[model samples]
Target: MTPVVELSGVHWGPKRQADILHDLTFSVAAGEVLAICGANGAGKSSLLRLLYRHQAPRKGTVRLMGRDLWLMKAPEAARIVAAVLQEQPTDFALTTRQIVALGRLPHRKGFGPGTLDNAVVEAALRRMDLTAFADRPFGTLSGGERQRVMVARALAQEPQVIVLDEPTNHLDIRHQLELLALLRGLGLTVITTLHDLTLAADFADRVLVLHQGRIIADAPPSQALTEATIARAFNVTARVDRSGPAPRFSFQLHG
Candidate 1:
């Protein structure tokens, strides 16, 4: 079976001088949740940009649903992959519903909003618990609320794959669990970059650790997030305890 997403020998960099991602190869099966974990400047965000086609890899191919991502039209790709990145676009004057309704742009048949489109937006609002705030201006919302709104927009897109860059950013503990749980329940192919190793271990079926532009570890979290791997990737002394669903860690900064 064809992988839902695949990258082979992918190398990417904004300039010709330095590569942010080097020879990165991975495949995500349909309906699997894969979390990418790494410290800062490990090219986590760059890899996501490749997946979403925001930036093309300087070398190698990114395939989606067995087709070349670059070969697909913008609307065609938009229908298959929806993303929630860390930075949001300016929506000062737009309401929550309006911001989410933009997700339907790929599916729009005519100029104005349709009944079905409106319904999808409504459903997304409810799913993200923004129904009461649907009419409120997006700029007025709290950071967590805005993050949820971004997710609602992605949900509204109804894509086969969801890519999130730090999906837990700005969310409180309760909402973090709620959002991660919601992602798991969706049954869609998910690829997210998370700084919290514990959250990655707890929520993801598989974890891939990136370091200095390469994948250092790729396996089930229990195997991938070992004490050795943690120390090497993070440059910190740490212990990994496998007593629960996710491996717990105790850390000491290296001197």
Candidate 2:
């Protein structure tokens, strides 16, 4: 089967700047959950931007379901890929339900939402447990509530692939587990950047580690997140114990 998301020889950066991600080549299988882990400024978010088509790669190609991402129309891409990024809507005046309803905008047949669209929005609201806050202003939500709202919005898109940048940010431990579990059962391609190695290991089918501007390891959590790889990627001594249900990592400064 064709890969859900693929990048061959991809190098990316803003115009006139050095590429921040270099020579990336990989494919994400349909319904697979992949996690990206790296230290600060390891180009994790930069890589996600390319996958979501928020920014085109400076070189090479990005393909979605066997088609060039740049060649697809905006609506066509929107129907296939949804993203929840750190950046948010400038207009916080919109209420929670309204914000999530925006996801259905790409699916509407006419000027506004129809019955099915409204139903989908309602389902997404409930799935994210945002029903109680549906009438609240988006800006009034706490950081974690806002994050869940954004995920709900993405779920409302009903895309084949979902891209989340630092998805666990601001979420409490229970919510974090709930959210990752939910993603696991979604049956869509999931690509996310995660700060928590244990969460990534437990929730993802594979883990990709990035360094200054390139991928260093792309493998199962057990192999990709070894003590050696962690030390190299994060510049700290790491002790990874993988004997349990999930990999646990301990870090120490390199002397």
Candidate 3:
């Protein structure tokens, strides 16, 4: 099967400063969840930005659905890839439903609601379990609720690929697990940056470990998250337990 997303020899950053991503290359298959793992300043978010065309690579290409991502027009690309990044306060004024309905803007022909758009918005709200809070102000919802509303908005876009940056950040364990499970069930091409190695192992079909703007490991979680690689990339000693369905890591700061 053809890959849904591909990056080859991608490099990006200020002309004078060190590149945020350097010679990074990887691909994600259709319906696969690929988790990007790294320490702070590891270029995980930069890679996502390249994929979604938020920032262009200084060198190399990012392809979505076999076409160059940068060459595609914004709305054309929006129709294919939807993203959920850190929410801003500016979004808080919109109600949960309104926030989600905004996803339909990419598909909207003119400045008026249609039956199909309304149905899609309602379905996305229901899918994200935001129906109960649909009319509530986005600022009033809890962090987990707000996160789901963001996902609902992404879903409303009807995207073929989804990209999330540190999606599980700040959520309690329950909400984190719930959100991961929901992503798994969607069966979409998912690319997300995850700070938690354990969650990445449990949720991602594959894991890519980045260090110093380079891909240090790219494989299934068990291989990519080995203790040695963890130590090398994260400067930590770890006990990697792969006896269960998913690998687990226990870490100690290395001297």
Candidate 4:
């Protein structure tokens, strides 16, 4: 099967010369959830930005299902890739439903939102369990509620590929698992950045460990979450145990 997203030697950053991602090459197949794991300043956000077309790569190329990302129009690209960024602002005074309905803007023709569009937004809110708070002001919601609303908005886009940056940031334990399970059930090409190693192992089909803007390890969670990799990438010692269906890590603080 053809991969949904592919990056070959892609390098991007603020300046034309300073490259954040150095010769990064990876591909995510359809219906697979790939987690990008790394410590702070590892360029995880930069990679996601490049994939979502927020910033173009200064070198190399990014292709979505064999089509060059740069060659695709903005709306066409937005139609395929939906993103829930880490830094979501709560300053927007719009209601939860209104904020989510904005996702349908790409498909909207005029200023007024249509019934069909509202239906999609409603469905998304239901999926995220935000129906009760749909009419509430988005800025008035709690952090976790706001996070769910953002996810609902992204789902409203109905994109083929979903890029999430710290999606579980403000979610509770139960909601975190539920959201991850929901994403997995969607069978969309998912690329997410997660700080929780255990959650990453449990949810992601594959894990990519980035260090200093380079991919240090790319493999299934069972194989990728080794003691050595964790210690090196995260600067924390850990013991890996596979007693359950998935490998679990117990952190060991270094002296």
RMSD each, Å: 1.0, 0.9, 1.4, 1.4
* TM-score of candidate 1 versus the correct structure, residues matched by position: 0.98
Report the lDDT of model 2 for residue 121.
92
- Per-candidate TM vs. native? 0.98, 0.98, 0.96, 0.96
lDDT digits (tens) for residues 1-255 of candidate 4 = 778999999877787467777889999999999999999999899889998988888889999989999999988898899999978755578999889987898777878988998889999999999999988988889999999999999999989999999999988999999999999999899999999999999999999999888899999998788899989888888898887776778886797
Better of 2 and 4 by TM-score: 2
Which stretches in model 3 have alpha-carbon errors above 4 Å? Answer: none
lDDT of each: 0.93, 0.93, 0.89, 0.90
Mind giving the per-residue lDDT tens digits that candidate 2 earns over 147-250? Answer: 99999999999999999998888999999999999999999999999999989889999999999978999999888998988999999999987678666789
Candidate 1: stretches off by over 4 Å? none
How well is each residue in 1-255 modelled by candidate 3, as lDDT tens digits? 668999999999966787788998888999999999998888887788888889889999999989999889998899999999985447687899999998998898878979999999999999888899999999999888888888899999999999999888768899899989998999999999998988998899899999999999999988899999899889888899778876668999875
CA displacement after TM-score superposition, residue 14 of candidate 1 (Å): 1.2
lDDT of 1 by residue, 100-207 (tens): 999999899899989999999999999999999999999999999999999999999999999999989999999999999999999999999999999998999999
